[model samples]
Each structure stands twice: as C-alpha cells, then as structure tokens.
Target: METVAITPLDTAAGAEQSHDPLRRQQAVVALGRRAVAAPDSEILLHDAAALIADMVGTDRFLVAESDPNGGQLTLQLVTRQRYGGNKPLVHHVALDGAQSLAGYVLQVGHPVAAEHLAADRRFQDRFLSRHGIQSALAVPLCLPHRSFGALAACSSHERIFDAGDLLFAETVAHVVTTAVARCRVEQALATERRLSAGMLQTVGAIVLVLDARGQIVHINEACQRLTGFSLDEIRRRPVWDVLPVAEELDLFKSIFDGLRHGLGPVQFESCLLTKHSERRRVAWTYNTVCDAQGEIESILATGIDITEQQKRQQPEETPDANTPAGNPPSEPEERNRQHPNAADSRKVPVRRPSPINVERRSRPRRSYPYRQSIAPVQDGELPDPAEFYQVQCNDIAAGGFSFLSPRPPESASIVVALGTPPSLTYLHAQIAHVTRMRKEGKWVYLVGCSYTGRAFY
Candidate 1:
C-alpha cells in the first residue's frame, strides 16, 4: 500500500547530468506507451522489465508471473546490467517453491524489503552474498482486479532503499503490471478473433465483413468458395461492385443505416450476384460491431446461399398450353363413353381443359390474413390487379410472398408494397409466366411477376 513520489531531477547540465534513475524512468514511460500502442503482447512484457531495471539502477530485475494452478511464480521477462569487471547477472530463476524473492512476493501481498539481507534469521543469505547483494525490493505486480505476479529489483548496497525509493519501486511495479495486463488482454482477444474467423471460414456458410463505407473488409473462405472471388480482389471494394444486385445493395444499405441509427441487429435477404458472374439468392443476418462507447465500428455479416435450394423448390420450367398433362387422354371411344357431350365432340376436337385445371378452379382462393397483425403488410396495402399491385412490405424480405392464383392469365396485374403508407408504391409489374409445382399433391401455379414498376425506395 506504499505510494511512490515523483522526484523531479534537475536537467541543468543537460545530457551529461542525466543519471541512471532519470534515464530509467524515461525508459519506463516509453515502454508503457509502447505497451499501449503495441498490436501484440510478447514485446510488451520483455520491454517493461528491462525499463524497470534500468530506472532503479539495479544489478538485475526479474518479473515473475504466477501460474494458473497457484503452484509457483515463473520468471517471464528478466533484465541484468553490464558491470565493468564482473559477469552480467543471470536472468534465470528456479521457482518450483516459495524460496526465491519472486516466490516470497507472490505469497505475501506486501512488498519485501530485504535491507538486512545478510543477517536476517528467516532469510537465506547465500544468493545475496554470491551476487554481492546488500539490498533488494520485491513489489507485487497486481492487475486492477486480479493478482498475478511480482516485480523484483536487486542491488549490492545495504539499506539503500528509502521511502522515496519504495515509492519509485511501487510505481515501477504498477508500470509492469499495466504492461503485463495489456499483453494478456491482447493475447486473449487475438485467440478469440482467430477462433471466430476460423468458424466463419469453415462452417459451410458464406460470411462477410463490411466497413463503414460499405466496402468489403473481409470475406470468409466459404464465401470465396461460394462466390469464386479472391480476398485481394474484394478488399475495400464496394459490395455491389463485385456482386451487382441492386436489391442486395439496397438491403445492405438499409441494414447499415439501421446500425448507424443505433439499431442492435437487423436481418434480411435479397438476390445476390457472385464473383463468377452467377446470380445467387441468399439470406443474411447482420450484427453491428460496436466500440467501447457503443458506436458502430464495423459490421459482422453471416449468411447462407440459398439460391440452389430455392431453385430446386421453384424451377424455371413454365406450364405451356402444348405441354402434356400428368394423366394421358384415354382412347377416343373411352373418352366419349365417359363424357358423351364433351367439348371435344366437334370435328376439330376443340381443346379440353386438363383435369389439373378443373381441380384448380374448384379450390377457391382463401383470403385469410397473412401474418396481418404481428407482421408488416406489403406496401401496407393489398395487391390490385388493374393499375399496379405493389407488394409493400418492409418485413419478410428474405422470403417474399407469391400470388397463388391457380390459373394465371398471360397478362394479370400484380402489386407489391415498396414503403411506408403514404410512400410511393412499386407498381406496373408484368406477369412473367405461370409455373406449376411438380411435387405430388402440390397443385398451386405461381404467377411470376416482374417489377416493370420502378424502384420506389
């Protein structure tokens, strides 16, 4: 609990007047700055101990970190001075038990002042005598909320440490603690980041990370495999520049705007274009990566390419008038016996509606509310067949709704909502084609609609 006082040294003589203590303090501060700025941890610990030893004019300094199992303190970073006639102090320590100064410091939270090292009854003096050590100081290097290690400073002079010296030593101890803590945090973060990146790359899903300006910061290996683009080609490029899908670009833009407005998480899906110049359909969920102040820093995007899955469910094959029916027509006599007055009685054998058509006409369109209350409606209005049916909806963009009118005429009108009520609606959609589901017992025909209607939002 001892506080170190800062003793201002007179710099009147400039460089010549600078002592080891002053130079060492400068080194300590410099190391602290480096620790703060360092992108990695290993150098931080090594530099911090060296700086501490230099500042205190110590023959040697050893930084020992406590083992996770609480067994003993292990020497992490060590510093020894170069003497004129003697060998440099060894940096190694044998710390299998509570015997060394480092071990004692870890065991007792209080700083150890080995001022009377030679004659102390409880202390062994051989190590001190061998190194000509008359004085030693060990301060526990404790993190803000965790106790881990100690900083030991040793000298060859007896009773050399004073209140001022103790204060300075403790300050140096704090510096070491800060550096060590920062390094530990950085290592942990790096590990977590690596694991996360690995998961995104290997989990069989397309993942992407975009920066503030909507450029690709990172895309996982899976994304590359799915899209056929190299990392170098995509980096810092606008997402749409690579995959030019206006719908997807707009979706990404909305998500970015939501995050910027402090929305926590947003999810949507749209048609995507890939690096191979192939069109893809995908579902994406985005989470905003925030800074310490809860401001948006970057975007974390996780997605799955469902283009194939969707294609399989809804094939491009359209139902044509000349296409054969699921059930073949019986022989001429059998057909007449079943329906004597059928339309085919004419010499020209007028075309007859297929059984699929008869069944479809019988099933009335159920106008039940489609997720009315809890979910948003398309463009907040119903589809009008005449003018332009605008499917206005902000919700359910991932899987859009399709009109299930069994017999879709060639030019039926359709509408889709494009924005909030009183907002402009996407209109003038043309019916592309009518495709029937081939799966057994599924009889609804999908009227493919295109937005001849311009983009409103």
Candidate 2:
C-alpha cells in the first residue's frame, strides 16, 4: 500500500544554491499556461507543486489549505517521497509558531523566505534543528479579500533559497490562486441553484413565473397536476397559448400589463383551461420581481386549485327551492333544494348565476328581495362606471350565484343593484365561470360569479 506522487523531492539540498532566474521565468510561463488549461483544482495544484520542486529545487514542497474554523492550515499536497504517499500521522499536524512556518504565510498574506531557519527569530531554533531544515521559503495563497492558505518549499542548507527562488515561487502561487478561486466560486453558485430549484418544487401551490415578455418562464409541480402539462411541455411558451382560454385571454393580458407597470401585489380568482380540455378555477396572489435597474423582470403568481371547493359550495345554494339566504328551508323546500333543478330546463344547470333579483338601494331591502328586474346596472360606485345588464335569474347564495346574460361581461367585475333610484345598493362581484348556450338567442350567456366582498350598500 505504498502510494506515491508522480514527482519526487530532490534530495540534493545543496542544489538550491544555484537558483537560476531564467529557469524560474520559464517555470512561471509554463504554470500560467497550466492554470488556463488545467481542468480542475487537483490537476492544477499537482502541476504547481511539481514545477516548483523541479525548477527551484526543494527538499520538501507542499500545499496547505486554510481552515478558518480551526485557524490552521491543513497540508494537502507534498513532494517529500521519503515515506511514499502513505506517509502517515506526522505531516498532517496543525501548524502553530512552534511547529511550522505555514501560519506566518497565512497571517502575513505574502511570501516569506528564511536563509537560515535556525537563526531566524520568527521560527523556533530547536524545532528547525529537530526537523533537520535550515532554510525555507513560503508564499501565502491569498484572495481578493481574504487569505486562504499557502504553498511552501524547504531546504536543509542555509542560503539555499535566494531572491530568485522567492520570486519564482510567488509566480507559481499566483497561477494556482486564480484558478482555485474561480473553481470555488463556480462550485458555490452551482450548489445554490440546486437548492433554489428544490425549494421551488417543495411548495404545494401552483407557481407560475412569467418573464417580461409574458412568456412562461417556469411552472411548479402543482401546476402540472392541475393543468395536465409538464414543465417541459409549457416552458418558454406564451402564457396566453398555454393557460387561458380565448374568453379569459384579454383579462389576463390586461392584468399582466398592469403588473408589469407597477400594479403592486394583488389577489384574484380566475379560470384556467387545462390541457385535458377541462376548466379549473384558481385563486391567485400575484407580485412582480424587478431587476437591479428597477424594471419589471418577471411576474410571480402563486395559486391554489379551488375548482373542487367552488363545486362543493355551489349545490348548497339552489334557486327557488331554498328560502332566503341565512334561513332554514322547510321539509318540502329542503327536498327540492337537494334536487338543485327547477321545472324550467334553462334554469336547471345555472347554479353559477349573475345578479339575480337584486334591487336598487333606492328601495328598502324588503321592497327588492324577490323583485326580478330586467334593467341595465352600472358600477355607479366607480370612477369609470361599467354598465351591467341584468340576465335571467337562477338560484342565489352567499358564496356565488349564476344567471343567463345576453352577453358575457367584458371583465370579471360587475355591479348588482339591490335597491332602486337615488339610494342604490351596488354589490361588486367577479365572474368565476361562463358557459355558452346553444344558438345565438336572447339571454344566451350563462355566467357564474363569486362575491368580491366589496359593495356600496
């Protein structure tokens, strides 16, 4: 089990006396080329250690890594072949002032040279004598803001390491440092990206990320489950082509436009046409992510698939079968309510209704409770009043209701007047569902709306 390095340390300790500047310059040039072409850290460090030992001459050459937590250097690569690569325990010891010179290089963040190790005040005389080392040179491995470790060479003879030796060693260290730093940064960034992607998938909600151009940048696993499309299937596609139906396209576009223009964070509910040709309702919370330039970079939307929740809340409110909201139905009415269908086929499946039997605020609550008026309603309550046409009524509930309109509302927002004339109760709602009726006849649009909790009573 004798493991050995490819390069062996020269035992001719006296050879350091003939340090050649030209040979050192050639070594530096070779190292510069190696730094650029070296595929990884281990290769770069090995070449650096070998070239230094060969060009400048060393009885011992090695690289040590900085351990910030332990405040020490951990010797990594060594050229001393005396015990082969399997040389155990002793060389791996932590260096303090009493043990070795690696600490001084790390602290000083520069190269150090000692012509006579025993005579140098900075190193212990007894320790140098015990290790049989007389002269040495060490160079710190430094970064832009911090020092990581050092590379060093030792000779058993005094005056063996000169100015030429120190300069050559530093050049080698420079090449190694730059390459190592780059690799370390790349490794850290790669790890961070993996963690980010994992966290994105960990979220249980449907996450849709749209770039500035309204392209689908990303969609999480929940989105795939709801829409029957994978990330690969929908990525980089236009949001309109992937998610929304034609009727919902323009509304989504306008909302995206406002969000890109600093609409801030908002919460709304809308329908998503899935890949299976099915509609799923989602309640979304949207916000924008901006770049360093303060321009809109992407829109982030997190939503929950509430189609089942809406379905459950629907049958609870049946037309004509139930009494008023917040009232208990009699036995006969309760039976009819369970059926969820009236005698008229048109009103049978219209649980998602528009403003049905809503009165104007001008009248009392009792005056307009069951008065089904065919009138045009206005969002009189807003700066830009939107005209809402009353459609044929169906059942009404506290959560949502359905109606038959002559045409679909331009936007999800609509106003239902509870009373008449000057004192009108305008209730705001968001269109949650829409179904097309057969043929182009009057009251051919079947619409369902959810209460938005905003009203002028």
Best of the candidates, TM-score: 2
Any runs in candidate 1 off by more than 4 Å, and if so which? 1-28, 39-47, 67-70, 76-97, 121-130, 144-148, 200-457
Off by over 4 Å in 2: 1-18, 68-70, 76-99, 125-130, 203-457
Best by lDDT: 2
* Per-candidate total of colliding backbone pairs: 18, 20
Model 2 deviation from the true structure expressed as Cα RMSD, one decimal place? 20.8
Per-residue lDDT tens digits for candidate 1, residues 184-302, read 77756864584476445537777777766668888888888878998898899977577647534544554466556554344444557776667876666566665445655567767
What is the per-residue lDDT of model 2 for residues 265-306, given as tens digits with 9 covering 90 to 100? 545556799899998877666666664367775677777877
